[model samples]
Target: MATLIGREIHLASRPTGWPTPDNFSLVEAPVPAVGPGQVLVRNRFLSVDPYMRGRMNDVKSYVPPFRVGEAMEGGAVGEVVDPGDSALSRGDLVLHQSGWREYAVLDAERTSALPPVPGLSPSVYLGALGMPGLTAYVGLLDIAGMQPGDQVFVSSAAGAVGSLAGQIARLRGASRVIGSAGTAAKVAYVRDLGFDAAFDYHDGPVSQALAQAAPDGIDVYFDNVGGDHLAAAISRLRRNGRAALCGAIAGYNAETPVPGPANLALVITKRLTLRGFIITDHRDRMPDFIKEMSGWLREGNVRFNETYVDGIEHAVDAFLGVFQGTNTGKMIVRLD
Candidate 1:
């Protein structure tokens, strides 16, 4: 049997507050040969995300947290190095749940072989054209019932999910689309992506900013960073306004939890509806999301940005950058 070699990182320890470089440990291993019904992948890219912070805690969650010393789990884009099943062949561009590694042996049924598009990068399967894209689509269309002419506001507007949410809102003919970002640069970035009004949440009170930007009130809130952002959005939502609680990054790294009254009383006063969902929670919507995103991408209407780190050794810093808003788009690590 042919022996293969690879580099890997495992969950060395869980973070108490913000994750540090020490929380992960790089390790090396000989890659296993592909077994029957499996395919070995040589990973090209891996994803680092804020949600992973939550997963590091051993507490109960929608998904289980990683165990200490275990390989940290996440999405990856790669190529098939050796095929052991008829479903996938060697040299296939693939996406898999391969984690923080340079190579992996996965069952053929567990990974997807990507269809080739001349200019599109395979990494898009991990970002705007992938889970983030699908999350925005499902949250807006199916969850929030974003009708044409509805005004939509998205938080964390320059990140992977928020960037696309703004563009989609515009494409849906929202009367006014607003977005909030952590810094002036990110605000400007979102505006460049076609937000009707964009604001740096750092500038002033978000509620006041919403008043100045919208004058009226927002109809839908695609919330990414929660805590004060959600509280502010609640104060400015119109009667019967809807909210898709997509993420709560504002509280992700806190040593103390950010309490969320978010004026729950307003639910009765405004007759509002709030829904929280994970992307994988709606797998049934994948076909529609892929069709729509592909069409917009082909039409050049929806654009995407990426911030890539060159290697897995810097993966910790890449992952930590999300909290400091160091990344302008999806933060990814090239593992080659």
Candidate 2:
């Protein structure tokens, strides 16, 4: 056997505002040897998400910031090349948090074996069957306390989490599902995903868009892009409405603080429940999420889209594309 040289994207510098290509560097290094209780994996798919932008900043948050000169981490699915002495076997597919790299050496316990889903690619574990999927499920079902026949609205509905959030609300018996996207094509895509209404936020004020989409007021709001969207949802939430404050991509790259919803007083007037959540804190719900989502996928009750950018070298571009709305669904990098 010969040595394996792998490439990984390192955070070269902290961005002051929106990150540029200069903020990342692709470096080649020897794949580390698997030691006891560890496994060597060759990553096949890497995820690029909006939340990762926040990790590039030097800030204290739910997750630690990505360190300069170090490989950034996110969700990845790979095949185990060496299982060392662990229960996992060579050639087994696994999911771990060692992304932004072509290969990873991980603790056996830290990596979860990915069972084969008939007719689905392992990359699905990186998207709909993975963290984003779980985030949508937990936020909408648990945090928001969504109920049947609820009129639900999801922002950034064309992105990975929001797309699934809107669909999950529909599948869970919401009477009406509305969404907002950044582009006309995305709005059409959201409508195709079963949203009763979807509008391009670029068309006009977000508040006006939400008004036309849900005239009677929304019973639940799954907020992925905050800022203006938050204010819009706050203004339209009915009494007792609940909001699952997921990611605020709108403020991820802000150099200074982004303003909060101006209509925040509506939270008081309507007695709405607005809660922010970190998906890591809801792992206990994964079992239920996987069980239900897997069934949905198998039965074709749920649909997902992924935009693949080939090669480890383009991973940073894929990451940046999320904020630019270059992807209609999950942005993924396919490593060779």
Candidate 3:
């Protein structure tokens, strides 16, 4: 019956290099009432991912840059508080792209109702069962053309997308799954998660580490961190190897142009296929991905981790933590 006051994190300024806390501001505002054909949602969780760093920059990319003084947006799961559409009811759980805020008012069509997954948390939709999951699914199977018994290598393997990508490869019958991470603990974690081999990139050069991990050469490379990792994968790929060009978090904060992989010539010499994709472009794959991934999660064939930072006020730190390698898995903010 009373107006709801909500808090949100806004992009205060674009960062020149690495983002700082000053780049974001948390402010309180009134939560708008649900209008005809609209729904009001109180967000319970917000996602902070490496891709967001690119969105903060004023550059032309697959997605538009975030506008200064506007609330940052990403994946979020919430409960509907006010429903103006006949299809949705109050108390229904939904997923939408109106995060970085405690409450959102949007057209009902923008929100997708989340069906209850027995024995799984609803917040999982913001991680393994959500965009990150879909990214891994489409990137590996469709883009990279993964085949059974292929040797697959994934960079940033302990993180959200890479973690799932490796497991998916294994579950789909990869003969060997190798992962590269930033720290020893992360390497161990991925190994326990079923990677046949895991290594800390900080311990040595990526090329050398990868070569040692996969002596015969890899058939599929799921690249998350570009730069040197790309070069390493290129050098070690067997003939006709395929690479799913995912995120390049290594260059996300670069003020200067980063160099292309010198060994890219291998793409031609080895006849490799390197392709980049935007997950939204493959929306038609969601039903299949959900069906398969849900089964995996239910059967414990796939596992995921999430680092939760409490409160909307700390959303900036959560976002920055992704680049700092502080989170071993998906970094999320608990806004409730």
Q: Give the C-alpha miss distance for residue 86 in model 1, angstroms.
A: 3.3
Per-residue lDDT tens digits for candidate 3, residues 1-336, read: 888899999999999998899999998988887788898889888999898888998888889999999998998888988888648888899988899999999788766688988887688998899989999999999999999989999999999999999999999999999999998899999999999999999998999999999999999999999999999999999999999999999999998999999877788889999999989899999999999999999999999999889999888888899999989778888876
Question: Which digits, one per residue and each the tens of the lDDT, describe model 1 over residues 192-265?
Answer: 99999999988988888988888889999999988888888898889999999999988888898678865889
Give residue 128's error in model 3 in angstroms. Answer: 1.3
Task: Output the worst ten-in-a-row residue range by lDDT, candidate 1.
Answer: 110-119
Clashing pairs in 1: none
The clash numbers for all candidates, in the given order, read 0, 0, 0
Q: Give the Cα lDDT of each candidate.
A: 0.87, 0.92, 0.92
Against the hidden true structure, what lDDT does model 3 obtain? 0.92
TM of each candidate vs. truth = 0.97, 0.97, 0.97
lDDT of 2 by residue, 1-336 (tens): 688899999999999999999999999988987789999999999988888887887888788999999999998998998889899888999988899999999999877788999988789998898889999999999999999999999999999999999999999999999999999999999999889999999999999989999999999999998899999999999999999999888888888898787787888889999999999999999899999999999999999999999999889888889889999888889986
> Model 1: residues >4 Å from true position, as ranges?
none
Q: Determine which window of 10 residues in candidate 2 has minimal summed lDDT.
A: 258-267
Better by lDDT, candidate 3 or 1: 3
